[model samples]
Target: MSNKYEEIAQAAIKLFEQKGYHATSVQDIADEVGLQKGSLYHYISSKEELLMKITQQSISGFNRRLEKIIETQVSAKDRLILAIQNHVVSVAANLEMTTVLLREALSLEPEHHTVIKNETDRYLSLWAQIIDEGVKAGEFKPGNSRLIALAILGSCNWVYRWYQEGGKLTPEEIGSYFAHIFIDGIKK
Candidate 1:
């Protein structure tokens, strides 16, 4: 992405994360980026348009990572653990952006919402496929792989809401703990 685009996106994400999407105005983002609101419009047609771009850009990067992780010549269980770890770290690193996605993405215009939803569904499918492979290989327990995938992923997404940057657990610690809980169960 262009530096201008990155600057605009970072500003927008921070604003959206802090003040929320509806509360944050184009002017706020422009001020954050040191651009005139009119000039900001030159780069983005509208605030909603910018939101869509940010959502898509953030997710597409993660999707690329997921694609690579899934393609690794590793056991399905190993891939799932790795995917969980990466998901946790990525969400923690981009907490604000991820929060915007979790909280503000649904408020997009219908077409934009559909685009984001489809991308999300595709990502969920990847998780399901990994779980399915594990089940088939007699690695993970057999049940609803899709539901299990959702539970695992939903837990990760919820992290943005409660995560403190310097809190008790680091991202890797949280990721590993979550993976262990999902893969091995909480019963001791």
Candidate 2:
């Protein structure tokens, strides 16, 4: 990404996280990035466009990472856990981007929303397929693979809200815990 685009995205994330998408304006991001209002337009067309770009960029990064993970020939269980680890670790590594993705991504234009949603659906479907394979192999219990996949994704995605660096649970530790919960339900 160009430095200008990065600057604008970072500023928008901070503003969006603090004041939210509806309240933030292009001038606000421009002020945050030390650029004039007109100069901001040169880098981005509109505040919504900037929001979409930021969201799309984050989603694309995640898709790329997950694609690499899917290509690995690990066991289904191991692959699921690895996916959790990569998601958590990558979120931790890119905190602002992750926050933009989870918290502010929904406020984009309809077309942009569809693009991200489609990519997300594909990612979820891959996880569901892995879980289905595990169930067939007797490694996972019989259940709704799609719902289970959604639960795992939701559980992992929500961590960015409370997770902190150098906290009691590291990303790997958190990833393992999540994997345990997914593989074995909370029943005794």
Candidate 3:
């Protein structure tokens, strides 16, 4: 994407996070990016298109990261730690996009929603695969891998709600803390 397109997407994410998708209009996004509403259409077809782009980009980036971690030859326990840390750090770094995704993703049209859902399911499956590997290797107690994956992702995703830049913990520190909690909870 061009720098201007990136600027527009960032502006849309900020507005969507602050005022919400339903409440935020194309005009609001255009004003945020210092462009006329008509000119904004040159970059995006509609407000929902912008929302879908932001949501897809954030989830796809994390999915790619998780896929790499899953493929590593490390122990499942180590992979899980890395996965948790990656998630927490990603959520913290993209809080505005994360918040917009959590709040407005369902607002997408049905076809768009389905695409996002499939991408999300792939992400969840990667987490479950790590847990399953750990259980099979006697590194973690036997349990529903899918459920455990959801629990870990839920905890990490919620960091966007309270994360502050220059808060008590840096993103990496918070990620490490979450990794420790999950590792201890699941370790055999």
Candidate 4:
């Protein structure tokens, strides 16, 4: 994407985070980016399209990083630690986008929603794969990998709701703490 387009997307994310997807207008986004309302369409077809772009970028980033972590030649326990850390750090670094993604994704058109849903499923499956590997290797106790993946992600994804930049724990520290909890919980 061009620098201008990126600027527009960032502006949209900010407005969406502040005023919400349903409440934010095209004019609001245009003003945020110093563009006229009509000119906003040059970069995006509609406000919803912009929402879709922001969400797609967020989920794709998570999947890409997790994919690399999954490919690393390490024990499943170590890999799971890395994955949890990656997720917490990513959520902290991109809080606005993450908030928009979590809170406003359902506002997308059906086709766009389907695209994000698929990407999300792919991401969940990556977590499931790690847990499954740990079970197969006898590192984690045998159980339903899919449900376990959901539980881990449910814990990690909630960081956005209460995260502060200079909070008691850094993102990595929080991530490591979470990793320890999860690893201990699942270990044989």
Cα lDDT of model 2 by residue, 25-71, tens digit:
88889899999999888889898887788778888888888888778
Worst 10 contiguous positions by lDDT, candidate 1: 179-188
- Per-residue lDDT over 1-188 for candidate 3, one digit per residue giving the tens place of the 0 to 100 score: 88999999999999999999999999999999899999999999999899999999988999999999998999999999899888888888888998987778999999999999999999999999999999999999999899999999989988988899999899889989988998899889
Ranking the candidates on lDDT from highest down gives: 4, 3, 1, 2
Ten contiguous residues minimizing lDDT sum, candidate 2:
179-188
Candidate 3 backbone collisions, by pair: none
| TM-scores of the candidates in the order shown | 0.95, 0.90, 0.96, 0.98
- Candidate 1 vs candidate 2: the TM-score winner is 1
Worst 10 residues of 4 by lDDT: 40-49
Highest TM-score model number: 4
Q: In model 4, how large is the Cα lDDT of residue 135?
A: 91
Please list the residue runs of candidate 2 whose C-alpha ends up more than 4 Å from where it truly belongs after superposition: 186-188
lDDT of 1: 0.89
Cα-based RMSD of the predictions, in order? 1.9, 2.3, 1.0, 0.7
lDDT of each: 0.89, 0.83, 0.92, 0.95
For 48-124, candidate 1 gives per-residue lDDT tens digits of 98899989987887788899999999988889889999999999999998888889998899999999999999999
Misplaced by over 4 Å in model 4 are none
lDDT tens digits, residues 39-101, model 4? 888989999889998999999999999999999999999999999999999999999999999
